[model samples]
Target: MSLCEAEKTFILHGVEENFRIDGREREDYRPMEVEIGIISHAFGSARLRLANTDVLVAVKIEVDTPYPEKPSQGKLDFFVDCSANATPDFEGRGGEDLATGISNSLSDAYRSSKAFDLKKLCIMKGQKCWKLLVDILLLECGGNLYDAVSLAVKAALWNTRVPGVKSVGIDGKNVELNVSERLNDCVPLDVSGAPVMVTVCKIGEYCVVDPSAAEEKCSSAALVVAVSQGNITTVLQGSAGSLHPTTLMDSLGLGVEVANQLNIALMETLQSAPPHFDVGFLK
Candidate 1:
Protein backbone atom coordinates (compact mmCIF):
# COMPACT_ATOMS: atom_id res chain seq x y z
CA MET A 1 0.00 0.00 0.00
CA SER A 2 1.15 3.51 -0.75
CA LEU A 3 1.06 6.47 1.62
CA CYS A 4 1.08 10.17 0.89
CA GLU A 5 3.83 12.52 2.07
CA ALA A 6 1.54 14.02 4.71
CA GLU A 7 0.60 10.56 5.94
CA LYS A 8 4.25 9.60 6.21
CA THR A 9 4.98 12.74 8.20
CA PHE A 10 2.12 12.03 10.56
CA ILE A 11 3.34 8.46 11.13
CA LEU A 12 6.86 9.66 11.73
CA HIS A 13 5.73 12.16 14.38
CA GLY A 14 3.70 9.44 16.08
CA VAL A 15 6.74 7.19 16.19
CA GLU A 16 8.83 9.97 17.61
CA GLU A 17 6.25 10.24 20.39
CA ASN A 18 6.02 6.46 20.85
CA PHE A 19 2.37 6.57 19.76
CA ARG A 20 1.05 5.21 16.47
CA ILE A 21 -1.96 6.34 14.53
CA ASP A 22 -3.75 3.26 15.82
CA GLY A 23 -3.15 4.45 19.40
CA ARG A 24 -0.58 1.74 20.08
CA GLU A 25 2.81 2.19 21.69
CA ARG A 26 6.04 1.37 19.93
CA GLU A 27 6.20 -2.26 21.13
CA ASP A 28 2.50 -2.99 20.98
CA TYR A 29 1.19 -5.50 18.46
CA ARG A 30 -2.13 -5.68 16.69
CA PRO A 31 -4.74 -8.16 17.83
CA MET A 32 -4.01 -11.69 16.61
CA GLU A 33 -6.10 -14.82 16.05
CA VAL A 34 -4.74 -18.33 15.56
CA GLU A 35 -6.27 -21.65 14.53
CA ILE A 36 -4.50 -24.99 14.29
CA GLY A 37 -5.14 -28.26 12.43
CA ILE A 38 -7.52 -26.43 10.17
CA ILE A 39 -6.70 -28.33 6.99
CA SER A 40 -8.02 -31.87 7.17
CA HIS A 41 -5.90 -33.21 4.34
CA ALA A 42 -2.64 -31.84 5.62
CA PHE A 43 -0.56 -33.66 8.20
CA GLY A 44 -0.71 -30.40 10.12
CA SER A 45 -1.90 -26.89 9.39
CA ALA A 46 -2.41 -23.52 11.02
CA ARG A 47 -3.98 -20.19 10.15
CA LEU A 48 -2.95 -16.92 11.75
CA ARG A 49 -4.38 -13.46 11.44
CA LEU A 50 -2.49 -10.50 12.79
CA ALA A 51 -4.82 -7.60 12.44
CA ASN A 52 -5.59 -7.56 8.70
CA THR A 53 -2.69 -9.77 7.62
CA ASP A 54 -3.55 -13.44 7.24
CA VAL A 55 -1.28 -16.46 6.79
CA LEU A 56 -1.85 -20.19 6.40
CA VAL A 57 0.72 -22.93 6.74
CA ALA A 58 0.62 -26.68 6.15
CA VAL A 59 3.07 -29.46 6.75
CA LYS A 60 3.25 -32.63 4.63
CA ILE A 61 5.67 -35.47 5.03
CA GLU A 62 7.11 -38.02 2.59
CA VAL A 63 9.59 -40.86 2.85
CA ASP A 64 12.93 -40.24 1.18
CA THR A 65 16.59 -41.16 1.40
CA PRO A 66 18.71 -39.13 3.77
CA TYR A 67 21.46 -36.88 2.46
CA PRO A 68 24.84 -38.59 2.15
CA GLU A 69 26.62 -36.06 4.31
CA LYS A 70 23.91 -36.03 6.98
CA PRO A 71 22.60 -39.56 6.89
CA SER A 72 21.06 -39.28 10.32
CA GLN A 73 19.26 -36.06 9.49
CA GLY A 74 16.06 -35.66 7.51
CA LYS A 75 15.03 -32.83 5.21
CA LEU A 76 12.79 -29.79 5.54
CA ASP A 77 11.79 -27.61 2.60
CA PHE A 78 9.87 -24.34 2.80
CA PHE A 79 7.61 -22.98 0.10
CA VAL A 80 5.63 -19.76 0.13
CA ASP A 81 2.75 -18.95 -2.20
CA CYS A 82 1.26 -15.49 -2.30
CA SER A 83 -2.33 -15.48 -3.41
CA ALA A 84 -3.60 -12.84 -5.78
CA ASN A 85 -6.11 -11.79 -3.17
CA ALA A 86 -3.38 -10.71 -0.78
CA THR A 87 -2.73 -7.40 -2.51
CA PRO A 88 -2.57 -5.75 -5.90
CA ASP A 89 1.19 -6.35 -6.04
CA PHE A 90 0.65 -10.06 -5.43
CA GLU A 91 -1.45 -10.55 -8.55
CA GLY A 92 -0.09 -12.88 -11.22
CA ARG A 93 3.67 -13.33 -10.69
CA GLY A 94 4.13 -10.02 -8.92
CA GLY A 95 4.53 -11.68 -5.54
CA GLU A 96 7.03 -14.28 -6.70
CA ASP A 97 9.99 -12.28 -5.48
CA LEU A 98 8.44 -11.68 -2.06
CA ALA A 99 7.45 -15.33 -1.78
CA THR A 100 10.98 -16.45 -2.58
CA GLY A 101 12.42 -14.01 -0.09
CA ILE A 102 10.13 -15.21 2.69
CA SER A 103 10.89 -18.86 1.88
CA ASN A 104 14.62 -18.24 1.93
CA SER A 105 14.39 -16.32 5.16
CA LEU A 106 12.52 -19.17 6.81
CA SER A 107 15.09 -21.67 5.58
CA ASP A 108 17.92 -19.60 6.96
CA ALA A 109 16.18 -19.22 10.31
CA TYR A 110 15.73 -22.98 10.66
CA ARG A 111 19.08 -24.04 9.18
CA SER A 112 20.88 -24.04 12.54
CA SER A 113 20.95 -27.38 14.31
CA LYS A 114 19.83 -25.70 17.49
CA ALA A 115 16.81 -24.15 15.80
CA PHE A 116 15.36 -27.46 14.56
CA ASP A 117 16.42 -31.04 15.11
CA LEU A 118 16.35 -32.89 11.80
CA LYS A 119 17.42 -36.12 13.49
CA LYS A 120 13.91 -36.50 14.85
CA LEU A 121 12.63 -37.11 11.33
CA CYS A 122 15.08 -39.90 10.50
CA ILE A 123 13.65 -43.38 10.11
CA MET A 124 16.94 -45.13 9.37
CA LYS A 125 20.62 -44.34 9.31
CA GLY A 126 20.82 -43.50 5.61
CA GLN A 127 18.16 -45.40 3.70
CA LYS A 128 14.96 -43.88 5.02
CA CYS A 129 13.93 -40.49 6.38
CA TRP A 130 10.87 -38.31 6.61
CA LYS A 131 11.04 -35.18 4.51
CA LEU A 132 8.87 -32.37 5.73
CA LEU A 133 7.35 -30.05 3.14
CA VAL A 134 6.22 -26.83 4.71
CA ASP A 135 3.88 -24.85 2.51
CA ILE A 136 2.94 -21.31 3.44
CA LEU A 137 0.12 -19.42 1.73
CA LEU A 138 -0.45 -15.75 2.17
CA LEU A 139 -4.12 -14.90 2.02
CA GLU A 140 -3.88 -11.24 2.96
CA CYS A 141 -1.26 -8.56 3.45
CA GLY A 142 -1.73 -5.91 6.17
CA GLY A 143 1.99 -5.54 6.91
CA ASN A 144 4.58 -7.26 9.09
CA LEU A 145 4.46 -10.14 6.64
CA TYR A 146 7.68 -11.75 7.81
CA ASP A 147 6.67 -12.01 11.44
CA ALA A 148 3.17 -13.26 10.60
CA VAL A 149 4.47 -15.94 8.22
CA SER A 150 7.07 -17.12 10.72
CA LEU A 151 4.51 -17.52 13.49
CA ALA A 152 2.14 -19.50 11.27
CA VAL A 153 4.94 -21.77 10.08
CA LYS A 154 6.02 -22.53 13.62
CA ALA A 155 2.47 -23.35 14.66
CA ALA A 156 1.95 -25.61 11.63
CA LEU A 157 5.16 -27.48 12.38
CA TRP A 158 4.08 -27.94 15.96
CA ASN A 159 0.81 -29.42 14.79
CA THR A 160 2.44 -31.81 12.34
CA ARG A 161 2.22 -35.52 13.14
CA VAL A 162 4.82 -37.83 11.64
CA PRO A 163 3.74 -41.34 10.80
CA GLY A 164 5.20 -44.17 12.83
CA VAL A 165 7.29 -46.85 11.23
CA LYS A 166 5.95 -50.23 12.17
CA SER A 167 8.76 -52.24 10.66
CA VAL A 168 11.86 -51.93 8.49
CA GLY A 169 13.73 -54.54 6.51
CA ILE A 170 16.94 -53.78 4.68
CA ASP A 171 18.74 -55.81 2.07
CA GLY A 172 22.20 -55.02 0.60
CA LYS A 173 20.83 -52.30 -1.68
CA ASN A 174 17.11 -52.20 -1.02
CA VAL A 175 14.93 -51.44 1.95
CA GLU A 176 11.32 -52.10 2.84
CA LEU A 177 9.26 -50.40 5.54
CA ASN A 178 5.81 -50.51 7.01
CA VAL A 179 4.28 -47.24 8.12
CA SER A 180 1.59 -47.32 10.76
CA GLU A 181 -1.88 -46.45 9.54
CA ARG A 182 -3.49 -45.79 12.90
CA LEU A 183 -3.90 -42.10 13.55
CA ASN A 184 -3.03 -42.59 17.20
CA ASP A 185 0.33 -44.08 16.25
CA CYS A 186 1.60 -40.82 14.82
CA VAL A 187 4.31 -38.85 16.56
CA PRO A 188 3.99 -35.13 17.10
CA LEU A 189 6.70 -32.82 15.92
CA ASP A 190 8.85 -31.15 18.58
CA VAL A 191 8.98 -27.40 18.02
CA SER A 192 10.13 -26.18 21.38
CA GLY A 193 13.19 -24.59 19.85
CA ALA A 194 11.62 -23.36 16.66
CA PRO A 195 12.54 -19.78 15.91
CA VAL A 196 10.13 -16.85 16.20
CA MET A 197 10.81 -13.96 13.85
CA VAL A 198 10.22 -10.26 14.55
CA THR A 199 10.49 -7.29 12.26
CA VAL A 200 11.69 -3.99 13.70
CA CYS A 201 11.07 -1.04 11.44
CA LYS A 202 12.94 2.23 11.82
CA ILE A 203 10.68 5.24 11.64
CA GLY A 204 12.24 8.64 11.99
CA GLU A 205 14.59 8.11 14.96
CA TYR A 206 12.61 5.35 16.68
CA CYS A 207 11.89 1.70 15.92
CA VAL A 208 8.58 -0.11 16.05
CA VAL A 209 7.27 -3.65 15.79
CA ASP A 210 4.30 -4.91 13.78
CA PRO A 211 4.14 -1.87 11.60
CA SER A 212 1.05 -1.35 9.49
CA ALA A 213 1.37 -1.02 5.75
CA ALA A 214 1.26 2.73 5.96
CA GLU A 215 3.78 2.75 8.79
CA GLU A 216 6.02 0.43 6.80
CA LYS A 217 6.01 2.83 3.92
CA CYS A 218 7.13 5.61 6.24
CA SER A 219 10.17 3.64 7.37
CA SER A 220 13.41 3.56 5.45
CA ALA A 221 14.92 0.45 7.05
CA ALA A 222 13.86 -2.72 8.79
CA LEU A 223 15.55 -5.60 10.56
CA VAL A 224 14.10 -9.10 10.68
CA VAL A 225 15.33 -11.12 13.61
CA ALA A 226 14.68 -14.78 14.36
CA VAL A 227 15.19 -16.04 17.86
CA SER A 228 15.06 -19.56 19.29
CA GLN A 229 15.53 -20.75 22.83
CA GLY A 230 16.64 -17.29 23.89
CA ASN A 231 19.34 -17.29 21.21
CA ILE A 232 19.37 -15.21 18.08
CA THR A 233 19.30 -17.52 15.07
CA THR A 234 19.09 -15.07 12.20
CA VAL A 235 19.38 -11.32 11.78
CA LEU A 236 18.52 -10.09 8.30
CA GLN A 237 18.59 -6.55 7.00
CA GLY A 238 15.40 -6.32 5.02
CA SER A 239 15.68 -2.82 3.59
CA ALA A 240 18.21 -0.94 1.47
CA GLY A 241 18.70 1.72 4.08
CA SER A 242 21.83 1.40 6.18
CA LEU A 243 21.60 1.65 9.95
CA HIS A 244 24.20 3.11 12.22
CA PRO A 245 26.03 0.75 14.55
CA THR A 246 24.11 2.02 17.58
CA THR A 247 20.78 1.83 15.80
CA LEU A 248 21.57 -1.66 14.59
CA MET A 249 22.43 -2.83 18.08
CA ASP A 250 19.32 -1.26 19.51
CA SER A 251 17.16 -2.82 16.84
CA LEU A 252 18.62 -6.26 17.54
CA GLY A 253 17.93 -5.79 21.23
CA LEU A 254 14.34 -4.81 20.53
CA GLY A 255 13.87 -7.70 18.14
CA VAL A 256 15.06 -10.24 20.69
CA GLU A 257 12.94 -8.77 23.46
CA VAL A 258 9.82 -8.73 21.29
CA ALA A 259 10.48 -12.23 19.97
CA ASN A 260 10.69 -13.62 23.47
CA GLN A 261 7.32 -12.16 24.32
CA LEU A 262 5.81 -13.38 21.05
CA ASN A 263 7.06 -16.89 21.68
CA ILE A 264 5.45 -17.06 25.09
CA ALA A 265 2.13 -15.70 23.85
CA LEU A 266 2.10 -18.02 20.86
CA MET A 267 2.74 -21.14 22.93
CA GLU A 268 0.08 -20.15 25.42
CA THR A 269 -2.45 -19.75 22.65
CA LEU A 270 -1.52 -23.03 20.99
CA GLN A 271 -1.84 -24.97 24.21
CA SER A 272 -5.13 -23.44 25.20
CA ALA A 273 -6.75 -23.26 21.79
CA PRO A 274 -10.05 -25.15 21.67
CA PRO A 275 -11.28 -27.20 18.74
CA HIS A 276 -12.13 -24.87 15.88
CA PHE A 277 -14.94 -25.76 13.50
CA ASP A 278 -14.59 -22.59 11.51
CA VAL A 279 -11.34 -22.77 9.61
CA GLY A 280 -9.88 -21.38 6.38
CA PHE A 281 -10.20 -17.88 4.94
CA LEU A 282 -12.32 -15.53 6.96
CA LYS A 283 -14.50 -13.22 4.94
Candidate 2:
Protein backbone atom coordinates (compact mmCIF):
# COMPACT_ATOMS: atom_id res chain seq x y z
CA MET A 1 0.00 0.00 0.00
CA SER A 2 2.98 2.25 -0.40
CA LEU A 3 2.34 5.47 -2.30
CA CYS A 4 4.68 8.00 -3.86
CA GLU A 5 4.87 11.56 -2.51
CA ALA A 6 3.03 12.86 -5.57
CA GLU A 7 0.27 10.25 -5.20
CA LYS A 8 -0.18 11.13 -1.55
CA THR A 9 -0.47 14.82 -2.42
CA PHE A 10 -3.11 14.03 -5.00
CA ILE A 11 -5.18 12.04 -2.52
CA LEU A 12 -4.89 14.85 0.02
CA HIS A 13 -6.14 17.36 -2.55
CA GLY A 14 -9.08 15.11 -3.40
CA VAL A 15 -10.04 14.94 0.26
CA GLU A 16 -9.86 18.68 0.52
CA GLU A 17 -12.30 18.93 -2.41
CA ASN A 18 -14.61 16.34 -0.84
CA PHE A 19 -14.31 14.11 -3.91
CA ARG A 20 -12.59 10.75 -3.77
CA ILE A 21 -10.89 8.91 -6.62
CA ASP A 22 -13.91 6.58 -6.68
CA GLY A 23 -16.29 9.55 -6.97
CA ARG A 24 -17.72 9.10 -3.49
CA GLU A 25 -18.21 11.72 -0.81
CA ARG A 26 -16.05 11.77 2.31
CA GLU A 27 -18.78 10.11 4.38
CA ASP A 28 -20.12 7.78 1.72
CA TYR A 29 -19.32 4.08 1.63
CA ARG A 30 -18.74 1.71 -1.23
CA PRO A 31 -21.50 -0.59 -2.49
CA MET A 32 -22.00 -3.62 -0.28
CA GLU A 33 -23.59 -7.05 -0.96
CA VAL A 34 -24.65 -9.40 1.83
CA GLU A 35 -25.82 -13.01 1.79
CA ILE A 36 -26.98 -15.08 4.77
CA GLY A 37 -27.15 -18.79 5.66
CA ILE A 38 -24.77 -19.80 2.90
CA ILE A 39 -23.24 -22.63 4.97
CA SER A 40 -25.62 -25.50 5.72
CA HIS A 41 -23.40 -27.42 8.12
CA ALA A 42 -22.87 -24.47 10.43
CA PHE A 43 -25.61 -23.13 12.67
CA GLY A 44 -25.48 -19.90 10.73
CA SER A 45 -23.22 -18.18 8.19
CA ALA A 46 -23.00 -15.06 6.05
CA ARG A 47 -20.90 -13.64 3.24
CA LEU A 48 -20.30 -9.93 2.72
CA ARG A 49 -18.64 -8.14 -0.16
CA LEU A 50 -17.74 -4.49 0.20
CA ALA A 51 -16.48 -3.53 -3.17
CA ASN A 52 -13.41 -5.79 -3.56
CA THR A 53 -13.10 -6.85 0.10
CA ASP A 54 -14.79 -10.19 0.77
CA VAL A 55 -15.51 -11.84 4.14
CA LEU A 56 -17.24 -15.01 5.27
CA VAL A 57 -18.45 -15.60 8.85
CA ALA A 58 -19.72 -18.82 10.35
CA VAL A 59 -21.09 -19.43 13.86
CA LYS A 60 -20.81 -22.76 15.64
CA ILE A 61 -22.27 -23.56 19.05
CA GLU A 62 -21.29 -26.11 21.69
CA VAL A 63 -22.57 -26.82 25.19
CA ASP A 64 -20.03 -26.57 27.98
CA THR A 65 -19.60 -25.58 31.61
CA PRO A 66 -19.85 -21.86 32.21
CA TYR A 67 -16.84 -19.83 33.34
CA PRO A 68 -16.36 -19.67 37.08
CA GLU A 69 -16.29 -15.87 37.20
CA LYS A 70 -19.20 -15.38 34.83
CA PRO A 71 -21.29 -18.43 35.50
CA SER A 72 -24.44 -16.87 34.11
CA GLN A 73 -22.82 -15.82 30.86
CA GLY A 74 -21.73 -17.96 27.95
CA LYS A 75 -18.57 -17.60 25.92
CA LEU A 76 -18.06 -15.93 22.54
CA ASP A 77 -14.80 -16.42 20.69
CA PHE A 78 -13.60 -14.92 17.43
CA PHE A 79 -11.14 -16.55 15.04
CA VAL A 80 -9.97 -14.85 11.87
CA ASP A 81 -8.16 -16.65 9.07
CA CYS A 82 -6.70 -14.59 6.26
CA SER A 83 -6.72 -17.00 3.33
CA ALA A 84 -3.91 -16.87 0.82
CA ASN A 85 -6.53 -16.73 -1.89
CA ALA A 86 -7.06 -13.10 -0.93
CA THR A 87 -3.49 -12.13 -1.71
CA PRO A 88 0.01 -13.56 -2.05
CA ASP A 89 1.08 -11.75 1.11
CA PHE A 90 -1.26 -13.96 3.11
CA GLU A 91 0.45 -17.20 2.11
CA GLY A 92 1.38 -19.56 4.96
CA ARG A 93 1.60 -17.67 8.28
CA GLY A 94 2.17 -14.29 6.67
CA GLY A 95 -1.27 -13.01 7.63
CA GLU A 96 -1.25 -14.25 11.20
CA ASP A 97 -0.46 -10.84 12.68
CA LEU A 98 -3.26 -9.13 10.77
CA ALA A 99 -5.67 -11.93 11.62
CA THR A 100 -4.81 -11.65 15.33
CA GLY A 101 -5.33 -7.90 15.30
CA ILE A 102 -8.75 -8.18 13.68
CA SER A 103 -9.86 -10.94 16.03
CA ASN A 104 -8.72 -8.96 19.08
CA SER A 105 -10.60 -5.91 17.91
CA LEU A 106 -13.75 -7.96 17.48
CA SER A 107 -13.33 -9.43 20.96
CA ASP A 108 -13.03 -5.96 22.44
CA ALA A 109 -16.04 -4.66 20.55
CA TYR A 110 -18.27 -7.50 21.74
CA ARG A 111 -16.92 -7.69 25.28
CA SER A 112 -19.36 -5.12 26.64
CA SER A 113 -22.58 -6.52 28.03
CA LYS A 114 -24.46 -3.65 26.44
CA ALA A 115 -23.16 -4.71 23.03
CA PHE A 116 -23.98 -8.43 23.39
CA ASP A 117 -25.98 -10.29 26.02
CA LEU A 118 -24.02 -13.42 26.87
CA LYS A 119 -26.40 -14.38 29.63
CA LYS A 120 -28.95 -15.49 27.09
CA LEU A 121 -26.61 -18.25 25.98
CA CYS A 122 -26.64 -19.86 29.39
CA ILE A 123 -28.47 -23.17 29.36
CA MET A 124 -28.40 -24.03 33.08
CA LYS A 125 -26.70 -21.24 35.00
CA GLY A 126 -23.24 -22.44 36.12
CA GLN A 127 -23.87 -26.03 35.19
CA LYS A 128 -24.18 -25.62 31.41
CA CYS A 129 -23.86 -22.90 28.81
CA TRP A 130 -23.65 -22.53 25.05
CA LYS A 131 -20.29 -21.45 23.71
CA LEU A 132 -20.42 -19.71 20.35
CA LEU A 133 -17.36 -19.81 18.15
CA VAL A 134 -17.45 -17.19 15.43
CA ASP A 135 -15.01 -18.01 12.66
CA ILE A 136 -14.21 -15.32 10.11
CA LEU A 137 -12.29 -15.90 6.90
CA LEU A 138 -10.88 -13.01 4.95
CA LEU A 139 -11.18 -14.02 1.32
CA GLU A 140 -10.08 -10.68 -0.12
CA CYS A 141 -8.59 -7.37 0.95
CA GLY A 142 -9.35 -4.13 -0.83
CA GLY A 143 -9.13 -2.06 2.39
CA ASN A 144 -11.44 -1.17 5.27
CA LEU A 145 -10.98 -4.65 6.69
CA TYR A 146 -12.37 -3.79 10.14
CA ASP A 147 -15.67 -2.49 8.85
CA ALA A 148 -16.22 -5.40 6.48
CA VAL A 149 -15.37 -8.02 9.10
CA SER A 150 -17.72 -6.47 11.67
CA LEU A 151 -20.61 -6.36 9.24
CA ALA A 152 -20.16 -9.98 8.18
CA VAL A 153 -19.90 -11.09 11.79
CA LYS A 154 -23.11 -9.31 12.72
CA ALA A 155 -24.98 -10.81 9.78
CA ALA A 156 -23.81 -14.31 10.67
CA LEU A 157 -24.88 -13.90 14.30
CA TRP A 158 -28.25 -12.58 13.20
CA ASN A 159 -28.86 -15.72 11.16
CA THR A 160 -27.56 -18.06 13.88
CA ARG A 161 -30.08 -20.45 15.46
CA VAL A 162 -29.49 -22.17 18.80
CA PRO A 163 -31.28 -25.44 19.34
CA GLY A 164 -33.80 -25.33 22.17
CA VAL A 165 -33.06 -27.49 25.15
CA LYS A 166 -36.11 -29.64 25.79
CA SER A 167 -35.16 -30.83 29.27
CA VAL A 168 -32.28 -31.66 31.58
CA GLY A 169 -32.20 -34.87 33.54
CA ILE A 170 -30.04 -35.53 36.62
CA ASP A 171 -29.40 -39.25 37.14
CA GLY A 172 -26.93 -40.16 39.91
CA LYS A 173 -23.86 -37.95 39.34
CA ASN A 174 -24.50 -37.48 35.63
CA VAL A 175 -26.58 -34.85 33.87
CA GLU A 176 -28.19 -35.35 30.46
CA LEU A 177 -29.95 -32.78 28.32
CA ASN A 178 -32.41 -33.19 25.48
CA VAL A 179 -32.40 -30.78 22.57
CA SER A 180 -35.34 -30.02 20.37
CA GLU A 181 -35.60 -32.39 17.41
CA ARG A 182 -37.46 -30.00 15.13
CA LEU A 183 -35.38 -27.34 13.42
CA ASN A 184 -38.22 -24.85 13.56
CA ASP A 185 -38.23 -25.05 17.33
CA CYS A 186 -34.74 -23.56 17.58
CA VAL A 187 -34.30 -19.98 18.80
CA PRO A 188 -32.49 -17.36 16.82
CA LEU A 189 -29.80 -15.23 18.44
CA ASP A 190 -30.57 -11.64 19.39
CA VAL A 191 -28.24 -9.40 17.43
CA SER A 192 -29.95 -6.05 17.81
CA GLY A 193 -26.98 -4.54 19.63
CA ALA A 194 -24.21 -6.16 17.61
CA PRO A 195 -21.38 -3.72 16.95
CA VAL A 196 -20.55 -2.24 13.53
CA MET A 197 -17.09 -0.82 12.91
CA VAL A 198 -16.38 2.36 10.95
CA THR A 199 -12.89 3.36 9.94
CA VAL A 200 -12.19 7.09 9.82
CA CYS A 201 -9.07 7.95 7.87
CA LYS A 202 -7.33 11.28 8.13
CA ILE A 203 -6.21 12.60 4.76
CA GLY A 204 -4.51 15.93 5.24
CA GLU A 205 -6.78 18.05 7.46
CA TYR A 206 -10.00 16.21 6.59
CA CYS A 207 -11.35 12.82 7.58
CA VAL A 208 -13.04 10.19 5.43
CA VAL A 209 -14.99 7.02 6.07
CA ASP A 210 -14.53 3.72 4.23
CA PRO A 211 -11.24 4.59 2.60
CA SER A 212 -9.96 2.43 -0.25
CA ALA A 213 -6.52 0.86 -0.13
CA ALA A 214 -4.90 3.85 -1.81
CA GLU A 215 -6.57 6.32 0.48
CA GLU A 216 -5.60 4.22 3.46
CA LYS A 217 -2.00 4.29 2.40
CA CYS A 218 -2.12 8.08 2.28
CA SER A 219 -3.79 8.41 5.65
CA SER A 220 -1.81 10.10 8.40
CA ALA A 221 -3.91 8.54 11.15
CA ALA A 222 -7.02 6.37 11.37
CA LEU A 223 -9.57 5.42 13.97
CA VAL A 224 -11.56 2.22 14.01
CA VAL A 225 -14.82 3.02 15.83
CA ALA A 226 -17.10 0.24 16.96
CA VAL A 227 -20.70 1.38 17.51
CA SER A 228 -23.39 -0.69 19.15
CA GLN A 229 -26.94 0.65 19.27
CA GLY A 230 -25.86 4.27 19.04
CA ASN A 231 -23.22 3.86 21.76
CA ILE A 232 -19.54 3.48 21.11
CA THR A 233 -18.26 0.13 22.25
CA THR A 234 -14.59 0.59 21.41
CA VAL A 235 -12.19 3.05 19.79
CA LEU A 236 -8.84 1.96 18.38
CA GLN A 237 -6.33 4.28 16.82
CA GLY A 238 -3.83 3.35 14.13
CA SER A 239 -1.70 6.30 13.29
CA ALA A 240 1.05 6.70 10.76
CA GLY A 241 1.42 10.27 11.99
CA SER A 242 0.36 12.35 14.94
CA LEU A 243 -3.14 13.79 15.25
CA HIS A 244 -4.34 16.95 16.99
CA PRO A 245 -6.76 16.51 19.89
CA THR A 246 -9.47 18.55 18.18
CA THR A 247 -9.04 16.62 14.92
CA LEU A 248 -9.27 13.32 16.75
CA MET A 249 -12.50 14.41 18.42
CA ASP A 250 -13.93 15.46 15.06
CA SER A 251 -12.97 12.13 13.52
CA LEU A 252 -14.66 10.27 16.33
CA GLY A 253 -17.86 12.19 15.71
CA LEU A 254 -17.76 11.40 12.01
CA GLY A 255 -17.10 7.72 12.65
CA VAL A 256 -20.08 7.47 15.01
CA GLU A 257 -22.43 9.13 12.54
CA VAL A 258 -21.34 6.88 9.68
CA ALA A 259 -21.50 3.76 11.82
CA ASN A 260 -25.08 4.53 12.89
CA GLN A 261 -26.15 4.96 9.30
CA LEU A 262 -24.39 1.72 8.30
CA ASN A 263 -26.09 -0.19 11.11
CA ILE A 264 -29.54 0.88 9.96
CA ALA A 265 -28.86 -0.07 6.38
CA LEU A 266 -27.39 -3.43 7.42
CA MET A 267 -30.44 -4.30 9.53
CA GLU A 268 -32.81 -3.54 6.67
CA THR A 269 -30.75 -5.64 4.27
CA LEU A 270 -30.59 -8.59 6.66
CA GLN A 271 -34.33 -8.55 7.23
CA SER A 272 -34.95 -8.68 3.49
CA ALA A 273 -32.20 -11.14 2.54
CA PRO A 274 -33.16 -13.89 0.12
CA PRO A 275 -33.19 -17.60 0.93
CA HIS A 276 -29.88 -19.47 1.23
CA PHE A 277 -28.15 -20.28 -2.06
CA ASP A 278 -24.72 -21.30 -3.39
CA VAL A 279 -23.40 -17.83 -4.15
CA GLY A 280 -19.82 -17.82 -2.92
CA PHE A 281 -16.66 -17.07 -4.92
CA LEU A 282 -17.93 -19.46 -7.58
CA LYS A 283 -20.56 -16.93 -8.49
Candidate with the greatest lDDT versus the true structure: 1
The TM-scores of all predictions, comma-separated, are: 0.96, 0.95
Please write out the lDDT profile of model 1 over residues 250-276, one tens digit for every residue.
999999999999888888777766545
Clashes of 1: 0
Let me know the TM-score candidate 2 reaches against the reference structure.
0.95
Residue-by-residue lDDT tens digits, candidate 2, 82-119: 99989777988899999999999999999999899999
Candidate 1 local Cα displacement, residue 101, angstroms: 0.6
Score residue 132 of candidate 2 by CA lDDT. Answer: 97
What overall lDDT, based on C-alpha atoms, would model 2 receive against the true structure?
0.89
